[model samples]
Target: MAVYQLDDELWFPDPHLGEEDGLVAVGGDLSVNRLLLAYSNGFFPWFSFRHWKEPHWYCPLDRYVIFPKEIHISHSMRQLMRQNKYIVTFNQCFEGVIRGCSSVDDRNQEYGAWLGSDMIKAYTELHRLGYAASVEVWEPQDMSSGKRSAKLVGGLYGVAVRNAFFGESMFSLVPNASKLALIYLAKTLDGMGGLFIDCQFETPHLKSMGGKHISYDKYMGILNGEKDVELG
Candidate 1:
């Protein structure tokens, strides 16, 4: 249980230890310099401060992601896209997107998000520093009958790690906010030579977008490729 890491990069714990081993070290300030190094080297903060002693770093065994070429927009969703009922914007409502994501009502038996106040604050700080980003899809302003609700509803927040954009979390207030955002991100990745979305976990919704599972070893290769890409 060694602790007291750094504000920048450090060796990750061996996956064999699992989440319980809590090994090696933790506790690093999330500076843009630090976060960039972490993502470049296949590490990311879980956005925690439970123990002031260390910042936990994890390299899960499985990575979830989707290839832009394989995106699946259902016929109904395609129709909706055609309607252009909602508009997508980048980095407009960062805190709102994060709050929406952090507070999404988990109707599908999904409960208890690990994105706590500390995590929110940490990532929010990242947004302030411009190291992190959020993509927002706004509900049509006129759509609100009483107009509280609109077609604009979902978006996500993620970190750009070199060519690999590590997805942190996302929420959908409207019907397809998350999916629409992912679609745009996929297009961006295709242009950036992005290899994968380091989705730490799996979800059926992501799978519907063609998210595939790959070993962490392979994921590391994508990050450490010979052609180094400069991310925006």
Candidate 2:
């Protein structure tokens, strides 16, 4: 399929026309309305400033996602939860969590970051408008005055539609910290009657945590079916 080039005006191509690698369109501004529109149609922007050279949009033929009911919690993660080793909170530090996700040293890749300043500004605005949200996992710090405080260790941020969470990125400072945050996010969303957590694309790490790939048609069916779920 041909890649559509978007103007400063707000619009997107039909998500079903995406290519194999999921490059559906390019060159659109990251306005909050545009972001919301894209996510509502099962599309998302994912580009590296260095590698891709442009802000590319994608809606893969197959999507990676975790249904709330299918969330997997390992024995070790359960132990962590049982021990209360981490504290999880929502929207407590959205900016900090995004910055941490952008700045963390990713041992997997040697170069660029997808969460550029433009992306950050756009999503920060989304949070301000209550469309985007964040989850933070913190570890306690010993205070000199004998009071206990928690410092940020791991977290994640995503966009929330009516009944679906479009996960953008996540970061971890301690082992399994991000995982703990994920567990909390999934379970909480489940408890609240959310549909699924869209992972966008696939990765081995996400797969290990129970993310599964489904055809875009099926995904859109689920999205539309859950659009009126009234998760709030």
Candidate 3:
């Protein structure tokens, strides 16, 4: 046993420092090295500075995951899919998507924008390095009129690691934009083998995509199996 244990406490200092599950440490600095290492080991920092004495690390016993092929599209969504009214593209506007996702002005979900300025800089840097990616949904306008045409509707941004994808966040300017993006993402990622999507926590939106919990060991294996991200 380690000298200090954060048992029953839902935070850990580093991935290696994590307990069997739930939490691992506290008060550790949130440096890039530590964050990256934590992710690589299936641990993530999810603390409330307002509530907790210090930052906490968590690696839940059951991880939420969605298989690409397992994505669920409703009949109404199918109609929208057939329309193809919106053009969906990858990595076209990553920062925009991140900002959209960072918005906390939605019902049911509380208004808490924790992505922070630091997060933007950090992920944007990853985007520059080609390790992170974004998907954009644009409403196409009639080109015959020669207008700039349409506005950005929705998008999702995440990090790709090997055959796995670590979903950061997503948002929609209009309803269903994010959902459409997820459908496209699932279809696109299906071609790759060993593809597993990590949705840090559970929600109704993710449940529709067949998100379920897995043993931490299983989650680690999937993350470890990924060697490099496939950019399209």
Candidate 4:
């Protein structure tokens, strides 16, 4: 299947026409309007810093997502949560979370990539406009002060459109920090009634947290069935 080449126009090809590797289109700027349109249509950009010639957009045949209410918390994670091992806050440090995610070193892993400077700049702008958001995990600074100050340890960032959340990346400086961030996000979304978290691609970690692979058609049904939702 030939990948569609996007021109100067702000448009994307039908996601169902994507190649086996999920490549739907190539060559497009990461403007806020473009990104928002892509997410609403169940498409997302995924390219490496080494291949910066043109941006590649994809919509996988097997879409992975997690219903907020269905998020699985392991016994260990529950214990840590009960102990208040980490404090989770939303939209606190958008840049810090993304920078942490981009800096994470997974050299020994098969699937590892960094968010290049261009991606960072684009997403930061999105956050400024309120489409993108972040969740921070922190540890207490000093108990002796009797005042609450936090030391950032881990977090995750994503773009929320309507009733869906597209998770971009997450990182942890200490064990279970990122997990806590995810748990908090899930619980909060669950409280908002029906919401979904787009995992994008399959990973063992995500699968363990109850992420499931669904057909693209089914995924679109959920995306299209919703009205524009406020992220706050």
Q: Which candidate is the best by lDDT?
A: 2
The number of the candidate with the highest TM-score is 2
Better of 1 and 3 by TM-score: 3
Clash pairs detected, candidate 3: 11-24, 11-25, 11-57, 12-24, 12-25, 12-57, 13-25
lDDT of 3 by residue, 1-232 (tens): 1314444333344344446656656556455555565666666655443355544667666788887878889998999989888899999888888877766466214423456565677678767777678889999776897777777789898777556777878888888998999888888888766377778788999998678777666677666663453211
Pairs with steric clashes in candidate 1: 26-54, 26-55, 27-54, 27-55, 138-152, 139-152, 144-147, 153-174, 154-177
lDDT of 4 by residue, 1-232 (tens): 6789998889998877879988899998899999999998888887576644768898888899888988999999989999986788999899999999888888213333537788899999999999998999998888787887888999999999977889998999999888889889999989986468999988998989989988887787777773443211
Local error of candidate 2 at residue 21 (angstroms):
0.5
lDDT (Cα) of model 2: 0.86
Full candidate order by TM-score, most accurate first = 2, 4, 3, 1
Clashes of each: 9, 0, 7, 1
Candidate 4 residue 133 Cα shift, in angstroms, is 1.0
lDDT of 1 by residue, 127-194 (tens): 88776788888876654467564344889898865666788878887677788888887877788766
Segments of candidate 4 deviating more than 4 angstroms: 107-113, 145-147, 226-232
Off by over 4 Å in 1: 1-11, 14-29, 47-55, 107-113, 143-152, 226-232
Better of 1 and 2 by TM-score: 2
Instruction: For each candidate, give its TM-score against the true structure.
Output: 0.76, 0.92, 0.79, 0.91
TM-score of 4: 0.91
Off by over 4 Å in 2: 107-111, 226-232
